[model samples]
Target: MASEELEYAGFWIRVWASVIDTLLLGIVVYPLLTAIYGDAYWEGANFVHGPLDFLISWVLPAVAVVAFWMARQATPGKMAIAARIVDANTGNNPSTGQLLIRYLGYFVSCIPLGLGIFWVAFDSRKQGWHDKMAGTVVVRKKSGTTRPVEFNA
Candidate 1:
């Protein structure tokens, strides 16, 4: 039998990818905050403080939105794992609006106890709820090319 054109990422792979992405984003964001605020920034607060605190509170989410929305993929983790986000039907990269919708849908997916993520385990197409809502799919990229799967159905 022919192999499936698209396969869902296994749970462990997805988990690892999340971890890697979080660490990478933190590596970039934290140092930038530190440099902008300096040692005196966190002088008295129990948590983050001063310009650094504001930056962390506000800028981080905005940056995350812009990065994913503009790129149609997460910054590092998905890229490292050869995974990318695209439109489910056309298998094309998402538009900026689609990316924003997808990112926002992540919040909904996280609600009701993250059942959306678990949908991959049972979905025939292995799509999460967020993927469905946003009309997006995550697929593995070929090593030397950008082509994604093409389905006749």
Candidate 2:
């Protein structure tokens, strides 16, 4: 399909979706972390305080987010805003490998003062580095429409 025919999610919508996802994650993560580490949880930068911390902070979130992407095409926050993640070249669900790469690509996107994320604001397709790495795009239902529009490479 022509690019103009698709309604790609822009930076602001993506930002809002991220905010929502972060807040929701906090709702669950904060209490659990606090319960495990007490007041010292926020006081340190240590990544692995214990097995529980490792499980809660690292493993759980990675599994949960990837699972959501694989099963639902979008996270809860993205879904709330009617956005879906798709393979940019095919406008279909991404493969498991692609999704995993996308998740890891987030680290790359964030490492350089978020330049990769900011690229979305300038790119015509609004793809961040992670999106580019995974060959994915975020799209939303077009105005007054029930389905998201398709796009191509």
Which candidate leads in lDDT? 2
| Residue-level lDDT for 47 in candidate 1 | 68
* TM-score of every candidate relative to the true structure: 0.69, 0.88
Candidate 1: tens digits of C-alpha lDDT, residues 7-85: 4454455667788877877787767776887766546565656566667756786677458646656556776676677
Query: Which consecutive 10 residues in model 2 have the weakest lDDT in total?
Result: 144-153
For residues 49-131, write the lDDT of model 2, one tens digit per residue.
89998898888888989999999988888998888888988887899999999999989999999999988898777789999
Give the poorly placed runs of model 1, Cα more than 4 Å off.
1-6, 31-54, 141-153
Q: Model 1: C-alpha RMSD to truth?
A: 5.3
